[model samples]
Target chain A: MSELWAASALSVRIAAVATLVTVLFGVPLAWAMARRKFPGRGILEAIILMPVVLPPTVVGYALLMLFGANGWIGRYLGGYSIAFRLEGAVLAAVVVALPMLYLPAKAGFAAVERELEDVATLMGANRWQTFWHVSVPLARRGLLSGIVLAFARALGEFGATVMVFGWQPGRVTLPISVYAQFEQGDLNTALPTVLVMAIAALGLVLVYNALASQRD
Target chain B: MKHALIRLVVLSAVLLGVPTARADSIRVGAAVSLKEAFGEIATLYKADTGETVEFVFGSSGQVAAQIKSGAPMDAFVSAAKKQFDDLVKDGLLDVETRHLVAGNELVLIVPAAAVKGGAVGGFDDLKKDAVAKIAVGEPKTVPAGQYAAQTLKALKLDDAVKGKIVFGANVRQVLAYVERGEVQAGIVYRTDAKESGDKVTIVATADAATHEAIIYPAAVLSKTEHGDAAGHFLDYLMSEKAVAVMRAKGFSIPTDPAPAAPAKPATP
Candidate 1:
């Protein structure tokens, strides 16, 4: 159905955007956590990874407080409202998916041979150059797998997205559509949407596994 | 290691046995709005009969779907007749046990701070430029949302306010949005508005003529093995004691006389 296709496309877009945002911020934060021995590092790591352990609804509620009209951050958006919009859904997905991406990316950074980075640095390469050339290439597979995992997680996100943006027609993702169909007792529609999501998720996991298993 | 494994198995068995060994239990699926009232009634029912009544609370549509999927619920108390009717049509519920229990009123609520300005008087005011967003449950899945939509349509304001609508998954979520001041106004049950304390103020009660009757219907499932117990629970729900509890929670008890309790079937 056209509705199903639209919902699937929207879900993919939301997840892709969320995953992109996650990687942009997560890679650097993960690298810093993995490579540094800074003070408060333990607390910082716990805060980054908190979403993984907390209930999705709790994360959603916290986001709601932070991004709501009366919220501290939301009040200063200068008349631009983020709640009940596609952007809010993306923000929700990023909150829930960030930890999933960060953890694996952190592990990837930690797994990279530090000696190679040091060698690159000693050869007159700057820190940023050494990181991109030596550290990133060595950990590319793990990082890619992490990105895939985060995309998959974001695609299936429901609790936080619902809490933050509710389920607007043009903004409803695949998971929300499936839930709405099921709740409306339209099993005919719900089952196929579920199947599509399941297959897509399986495909994502397969890609991740393939990338992860590749020998560098 | 072998002795410890045997001990662990024995411990697990004992833990699992504790509940099944006690009083007979029945699973009742009720709408989320009925949670507090039903929980109190459940406690009272347990005190009187020594029976354990477990409740599964969710949106009426979701609960009905579970019943259709053959959820092991002994009784279902729904916030809407459509869900009950659907189950009856599917032969999942005993038609004879179905009874209208209580009624609720839909109300428009605004954040407490907004009430002073009086900028929002009713559904028409929602079209004002100052009202940025309005929250209502998703009409496709929530009964409260259906009523809200009906009311809006009746007032001919559906088209005018269509763009400002934000749908919550359920009535409680709508209430939350209003309570948190995330939306300028929200539509929810009067009871839900009451629960939000000082955070929200009721702006108007939707006219009953605008929407179908907001009724709660209770029924026993045909698939229940504990038919007698389920029937008894249904009877208890109609009793004056339960009616009082429902009333206290802002529900209007049905005026119809209570159905006679069914005779308990002989246990094998």
Candidate 2:
């Protein structure tokens, strides 16, 4: 079934874009969390970790309420409806994968020697340049880990995706396709997509391992 | 390991990325409930016409969404008229080619061994002490689940079995849950029980009067490239050979007008 391939392609696009979104939002937040003690910092950390602890179905239900047709946000964005569309799938992936990116990034940033950023600052590097040129390179392993892990998690996102995006053309991701085929009692038909995902996930883990060990 | 991954990528690219539809084949999006019956029908259809009818099976609601979003299905066979009618309103179906493929009866099923002692007899018996959990498809998307809810409500037993109901995503899932003995019983089409062989027992058949009439409506898609082939496939669904296969699989020819769903919902 071509559905399998379409789903695979959809999954990749959703995850890749989702990871980019996660990095955009998560990395800055990770830096703040790692370096600054803000008001209600504990609450922020709890919310960031909640996704990993919550049942995916509950997360899906919560998202459906926030992004469904009748949801306030959805109603306001009628012309740009995210529900039952590719954007909704990417949003779900981004939401679920955010913490996967944030935790590693925070740890990576924290592990970066403060002295390096201080040295860069002393050597006439501006705050932005020092943070980007010094802190980023030093935290490379953790950042790479987060990206790969986030991408993998995003690629496999399903419950929230099916709840918000629903299963339709331009939106059916790999997991949903596999569910549809298996629901039909067609295991043979579901196998190729399953294999693709399995191999892809394995490859990501290897990539993460290689990156983790590169310095050693 | 790297080579293996590379080969898998290329193999899947060749096998799944490219279009699987041939000029002579018509891509059909069908309800998953037809998996067994249509598998047999497709075989007979291919033998008779030498045309491959590639079926993409899912819940009726799912198939409707696919048709709405333009999944390139040449035809559709919906489990009920609501989905079919929805497609009609969306201007996705070739209304002239629509036909009633069969009428199905909703039945109560249990693990084959559970009823060996006749512990459960009917819908009312689902509330019995021995039955702890009953599986039904989620009524929102799965048509059989909606029908099951209606059947229980008509029998004034919905309230009694409400707490113990375990919602499966689809009828096959409900059947599987019952077969695995994960649930004491399930409500599904009689055809499911037929395919299940000895894995599950048909404990009781719901009376037709208790719920909306179950119907399967088949139609060619409006945007089909192989319109002629799709129309012929619809015709084949009505042919004697296809009917025989359907009948053998426990589907009954409907006496009602084709596409006129006998439910309170508007007929397709």
Candidate 3:
């Protein structure tokens, strides 16, 4: 029973870290995508959407190649022993979860009326001030929704995390733990972990739907 | 869209139907290490006896767990004894049907590019700062990991080398790490090191005295509906015919107190 909670708790921690990291990077990227018309916007969008299209294992292996001890970046950082540890798992989760947060964030930012930003700018406000005071306030609902979606996606991400982390118990999170327990035929241990994930996932969806309905 | 959907449905149905048509087949769960070797034998057995045998292969821990959870398997061939003992405790194995069929030995392995000074010699050199990482199986679930842990503990080097340990999911995965040069060294079965051909070099033979005996055991499950067929399969494994296949794959014949394997030329 404690094992199940420990796994889920680690999953929650991963999702939280992924959500935080995504929003830190994603919102700005989304706003840039929404507001700026660049020469390679389509290519940029395609690159951002790559994780969504690729199999989770492919993403995981890519993460492994990038963050693994002998990986390109990992080689430079080998002195630190970055890959296959819990930190690598978090990085993998964030990579997989980025698109979920980015799509909704871009949509939310795009839906913000250009006139409001223009008016704020006309009042001598700078770009940053206009964004915070005018654009962000109007797109708050979309930002909130995207955070929920990102959290959900991160919670459910398995393949990439497992491929990189290799199911190091008490370190990697819920899904891999359930898989390990299931493969070991410890049903008494696995079932409760699965049930907890199910409930948490369900709770997030329900809350997201309720908030979306209220916003509507 | 509808035509594509119909094609998908038909494809899925055909896939599902093929396995169900062979309902009388005995599903035998064996270790991943035995996949290529046993797959060859199973094909021969089917042709010779006209009895279909289907095999599902993975880590011994995984196979044992699957059998315990009522995975509809008729028999189990495990790479380690602990899993078999667990099944016996669960009363899932037929008491009279059990036998030790094959044996494996642990060896240190390194990438072909790395072996120097006539192999690693012993565990002392493994702790050199130049040795950045050392791969072993996950100690909890893999037999190789258990043996590696036992060896390290016996040498009192477990604590000294704790920080350098990077776990592979199984013996094969450990071999993969060494083959790719992802780690400085790894521990895997002698057969794995041999079968890897030129990809990896055997570094040293881990002494059997350092760890528990590594034995492969086979048994028919008590729940097997086709008990007669299962018994015949077990008998066949012990027969000279199958023993030759096992031996050719670097497995030794099991004995009361397994003899020390003779040192041999490393796989070229």
Best lDDT among the predictions, by candidate number? 1
Query: lDDT, candidate 3, residue A92?
Result: 79
Question: How are the candidates ranked when ordered by DockQ, highest leading?
Answer: 1, 3, 2
- Candidate 3 docking quality: incorrect, acceptable, medium or high: incorrect
lDDT of 1 by residue, B157-264 (tens): 898888888887678888888887778899999988887779999989999999999998888898889888988988888888998998988999877744453444
Q: Please rank every candidate by lDDT, starting with the best.
A: 1, 2, 3
DockQ of 1: 0.57
Listed models, DockQ each:
0.57, 0.02, 0.21
* For model 1 chain B, the run of ten residues with the poorest summed lDDT: B257-266
The DockQ of predicted model 2 stands at 0.02
Clashes of each: 0, 0, 0
Candidate 1 local Cα displacement, residue B265, angstroms:
20
Q: Between the candidate structures 1 and 2, which one is better when assessed by DockQ? A: 1
Cα RMSDs of all predictions?
4.4, 15.9, 7.0
- Cα deviation in Å at residue A88, candidate 1? 3.1
- Candidate 3 lDDT, B174-250, residue by residue in tens: 88877866677888889888889998888688889999988888888988898779878878887777888888999
Could you tell me the lDDT of residue A101 within candidate 1? Answer: 88
